[model samples]
Target: MSDEHPEPDGRTRHYGDFYGLSEPAGEGDVTLVIGNCQAESLRIFLDGGGLRTVRTPPIHELVEADLPHLQRWLARTRLLVAQPIRDGYHGMPLGTAELAAVLPGGGRLVRVPVIRFAGLYPAHVIVRPPSDPSLVPPLVEYHDIRTIAEAAGQPLAEDALTPDLVRRVAELSLSELRRREVANDTVVASDLFAAPSFDQMRTLNHPGNPVFAALAARVRERAGVPAFTVDPGRPVLVSVHAPRERAVLDAWSLDGEPTDHWVVGGAPIDSEEVRRAHLAWYAAHPDAVAAALARHADTLRLWRAITG
Candidate 1:
């Protein structure tokens, strides 16, 4: 929103400037939210008076080259809200621990968990091609886990997409998510599984607004800030939405409209089109497919169990 519209190279790098508000009353009132894709929504919810909230490019997207931009923004941050990032991440000093080290005395750093729940779309995953890890995949990163399973020559049974199997996958998804989020600190949106207000997620990683609003309230509690007041009126993370299969809804007893098609940038996409494209891509690049299979091997084993 601050004229840094396009992420440097097409990745969601430059993001989260709300209400055209950039400057704060004091330098100590600056806050920066850093993490993966969900960080943008958190940044927007954290928007209001007092703190000049700015969100850096998603931490996973930042490279050694983007250090200057990250550092420039970090220098102005007094209240840094970040997910758990390890030091030397991406061969640079851009981790949450790394960034927190640069904060001045009395500056605050609030830890926010990276919220992800697969109860909504258990088959979807975000994978990086082994060839060019930076290339934004078609449809903006929603890949069916079954694609990688097939690429690895691991096929599922014809009847494996059952409600029972979906429920097990959802359980495994929750276990892995809690393992990652709880070990850090408070888990944001952990209660979203049966939340009455929202469906929890449009995809595995992209959460609905209520999840973010809850996270903002957590950040405010830790940062000693006033209540968040800026409401975007529309969904903030609406660029790409995964399908709401009937199986997933019944698996979690979720309440929402169901569509087998994906909604990308407000446009519907046939799931078959996505499957064909991904299969073709894998066929063209066998080596990359192998790498992805190997990387997701452990997860695949769990998925395999659910299928068989």
Candidate 2:
């Protein structure tokens, strides 16, 4: 297919450039899909499950009348799978529930919660010596990798401190950590991309990770669409790095007792294996992980004793 198509308004536009196209689909026969970048990957998975999807501008664009073609497509769509993103990157303020009122007859809706960014905000590391109560509380706060390296007395070369650069380091570190945890076991491959890093403040929806796949499967099942599975495993990163996302489904709009709604504050599906890996890593590295925990515990105890 040609990369660009002309709209009725006399402007040439490329369909699905912002979000990749699975296959050419007819108007009204297509599913209206919207979300962050992760939503784009889900479109790939859905296409793999045999569904035709078309990208529409986000709610903010809709409300502002930015992408005129989207408003027209809204009336023709048979189904919509909406995964609301954070309030940045052309995202909506809350949920995409506002679009429900404008759907065509017999239109079905599926809402998946937004993905949370792991390190969008600054993270502070508190350090207090275990043996010395008199030592000052040493705190190091950083959001990007350059600052992190600087704090560790290993500043990177000036050209090697971009957001993508920092993300590469985080990816390598996480991969190594997971490998050590598995220790020769055939671990499942899981690449989590919907996370905040030095490269970007907010993350789009990412697929391939188990939590993302589980959430997508729930949407498909509820809509009576074909089910698709993703990678079964996920990495247990720093909790602050993988914050719980915002809930997407609007309970008030349900025609009856709701069957399912997007979940927040925790993973939508069971991920005990991730937890098990973490525990195993700590167990195997008692001298490092255990000692670190002990130091933190001691710090907390000291703070409590002084306050009490």
TM-score of the candidate numbered 1?
A: 0.81
State which candidate has the highest TM-score. 1
Whole-model Cα lDDT of every candidate shown, in order: 0.70, 0.41
Best by lDDT: 1
How well is each residue in 1-308 modelled by candidate 1, as lDDT tens digits?
45667324333323423222243333337788888888878888887757777656777767776677677667767788888988888888988888988887777888888766766676777667667777544654666777767766776565556566666666777777677777877545565565322345777777888788777887887778877566779886777788777776666566777786888888998887888787777777676667767765665666667555
lDDT of 2 at 107: 85
Among all windows of ten consecutive residues in candidate 1, which has the lowest summed lDDT? 12-21
- The lDDT of model 2 is 0.41
TM-score of 2: 0.39
Deviating ranges (above 4 Å) for candidate 1: 1-28, 60-69, 195-198, 255-257, 295-308
Q: Which pairs of residues collide in candidate 2? A: 38-205, 38-206, 118-241, 163-198, 163-199
Q: What is the lDDT, from 0 to 100, of the residue 250 in candidate 1? A: 69
